[model samples]
Target: MSYTLDRGDLADLARGAALLGTGGGGDPYIGRLLVDQALRHGPGTITVLDPDDLRDDDFVIPTAQMGAPTVMVEKIPRGDEAVAALRALEDHLGRRADATMPIECGGINSMIPLLVAARTGLPVVDADGMGRAFPELQMETFSVYGVPGSPLAVGGENGETVIIDTGADNRRMEWLARGIAVRLGGVAHIAEYAMSGADVRRTAVPRTLGLGLRIGRALRAARENHRDPVEALADTMAGTLYDKVRVLFRGKVVDVERRTEAGFARGHATIAAFDGPRTLELTFQNEHLVARAGGEVRCVVPDLICVLEADTGEPITTEGLRYGQRAVVVGISTPDLMRSPEALGVFGPRAFGLDMEFQPVEDLVPL
Candidate 1:
């Protein structure tokens, strides 16, 4: 059966995107708002195409935003940048993309593709390159299947556009892009990793858009029906249920030691957990990369570590993590994507400079 994405699906899309993000896609809220606005303004329809439905000759591209998520919230998208990015890419390739897909499912990147689709009058595939979010561009499933990430286009907020096809590796590509992103005020719109539709079908994570819709709906329903948000989340992800934890701390961030040299939002969040003489430490770069409970390792890379509202289990992005947040710490397991050796090699503890060996959350969690 064919699938069609509509306005009502945004909530599910957002929730599913968060789930797939494995606690790392920056906040899904902005993406939801952006996409919601785009749909309302243009009222375009996104037609879902099965992988087999795509033609071998059909031009396809996976697109997203590049920069600190914190920058995105403050800078706000010019609203034209996503479409502009696609146009810039089309101009370079001298070909129109028949379809577009999200590079990742959570945060701005997830919904940016929808806006791009509306603007370009192209249908968006009901899938993404990564089932969940990752820190680097090359970490996508597209990269796993040998797709090249460049000759890409980035659209700045001021209606300016830059194209780069650095011969360097992914890290270098990140360096070059981030240099421009910083110049653009830490946010930029980009359409990259061009490939044919057939290739996208093979490399992309299928049905994630639909899954996203399911999650959004579940979250909304839970809120309206006064159901347990955590249980709703568990149902959607098929995740194991854990006892809800209390707020360890809440306070204005007294200090944040941060560095963007890694092309990620590298920083530590020290919060006064609820009570006397106690605090929680969160280490992150882009996504929440690590968490500590009273300085003891509670979670690390390849696992999902998120800071949410103390009262509500809503996620807080790395960029969104601030001082003075009354927050609860939740550790969700990473999706199956990172379990693969290739995926692990890119984002495992070693990749994050940890001396400890990797352990799947399923193994570490109490059964």
Candidate 2:
């Protein structure tokens, strides 16, 4: 299955990407605007191709903006950074890319690749490495499946380009990329996880772009029809990889502790019931990793823990959380591949330095 992404789909795409972002991936609002402007003068539409439709030898590269999420909102891209990065990588590889793919299907990263594809007239793979957003580049199915993460290409807005060609692993790639991003004004367009179509079909999370679009459409329809947006999201996600969705907490932000450390937005948020003492604490490194209430774990990383505006049903990223705002916390299960023992070793709670056993959201907190 395939769909053409045009300007009309920008809002829904951003909305859905934000929901899947799980409180990270940077803001999609700017990304939508950038893509909208590009479409106005560039290609009329971007074709999203299914992973299964690719030839075994087709070349695919995943693209994303790497840096602190907080920094991205302040320093918007030049609208050509992703394409520039892709071009640089293609040059370094001595071959033109066949298509672009999202490293993850969340927030601005999901749309960045679409912009690249639109400008280059390349189809985008319908799949991604992570079904949801992750803080580190290594926390992807590509690494779990033993795919190389370099040679990565990082590009800046002002004609700056850096090519990393090394035998280092994915973790080292992330470290080197982070330092380069900080040097390049805290955000850089990155092209990595280059793989053949056969590898993508074997390791990437399939159909996530379509899933995000469906989720965005569901929320919009729910709001228009005066239905419960949360329920609408749950129904829309039913039977998909993220099948279960539930409201874990209904409260207001009472306190927040966040700081940008080592090129990541590391923080924690405290939410308390409007009329009760029940409180929930969430910790994160770009994305929320753990959700606990009264010293009990309600949700953990790899499983999504999203915070949304209670009234608008719009997701609020970690950087956007503020004191005294009414919010609803929602949890969804991760895709099966992300929950596998090997996959979990990279993104599970223990991976984040938390001493807790990994548990599915469904088992930890019932809907």
Candidate 3:
């Protein structure tokens, strides 16, 4: 499904995107404000397209912000780095970008491509490289499925730009860009994973943008109707790619041990149940990677462990986790494409250094 994305869609879009982001994309509030500004002065509205809408030869590029989400909350973008990075990548590739897509479907990342489209009059594809957010640049289906991530551009707020045009592997591109992003003051806008429309249709996760919008609208409607917003979120998630959604834990944040290290936000969080001694332990590198309770792993990477405000069902970024806040943790299964043996090998448990096999979140019942 394709549609026009204007300011009216942003509030809910950001809400839903934050939930789908799994807590690692850039700040959703900041991203929403940027796109709102873009609509006010740039294109006024962005056209969103389905991946199948693209011609086989159309030039598609994915754009995102690379670095700590914690850093982004304090250092707002100058509103120019996205287009600057896009331009640099376009110049390196020797062609104009026909359309832009999100490397991952996360808060800020989902908005970044629209920010670019708002500034440049390009359409945004409805699909994304990852169905949800991940920390590393290489942890995306676009790259794991054989698309090169180099010939990419990274740009800073002070107008500095770097174009990495190379045949090196995706991990190497992530390594070089990550170091540069840290040097660029802990964050930078990037354009990478240049591919054709056919490649996108084959490799990208489809309709996530629409899914996000539906989720946002559902949450808002539930709130207006005085229903349980978290229940509404789970209902909205049903019949979609992430159908196996459930409320795994309901409690207040008891502890958060977070640190900004090596250009990523790495951390662990503990949530204690409201009425029991039960607790959920979360380990993450940018996005929430694993969830465990009473020594039983409830949800592992590749599946999603999303944390939301208990009352409002507002999604929280990893950087936003704090002690004493009431929260609800949801376990959602990923699309089949993301759970395949080959795909799991790239982003599954071992990829995040967890010593466990991948299990569907639904299978991990109460301990």
**Which scores greater on lDDT, model 1 or model 3?**
3
lDDT of 2: 0.90
Clash pairs (backbone) in predicted model 2: none
Ten consecutive residues with minimal summed lDDT in candidate 3?
Answer: 358-367
> In order, what lDDT does every prediction score?
0.69, 0.90, 0.89
TM-scores, all candidates, are 0.84, 0.98, 0.98
Instruction: Let me know the TM-score candidate 2 reaches against the reference structure.
Output: 0.98
Best by lDDT: 2
Considering lDDT, where higher is better, how would the candidates rank from best to worst? 2, 3, 1
Local accuracy of candidate 3 as per-residue lDDT tens digits, 233-340: 878887899988878899999999999999999999999999999999999899999888998888888998899888888888899999998999998889999988
Instruction: Give the winner by TM-score: 1 or 2.
Output: 2
Off by over 4 Å in 1: 15-27, 50-52, 239-263, 270-280, 294-296, 322-326
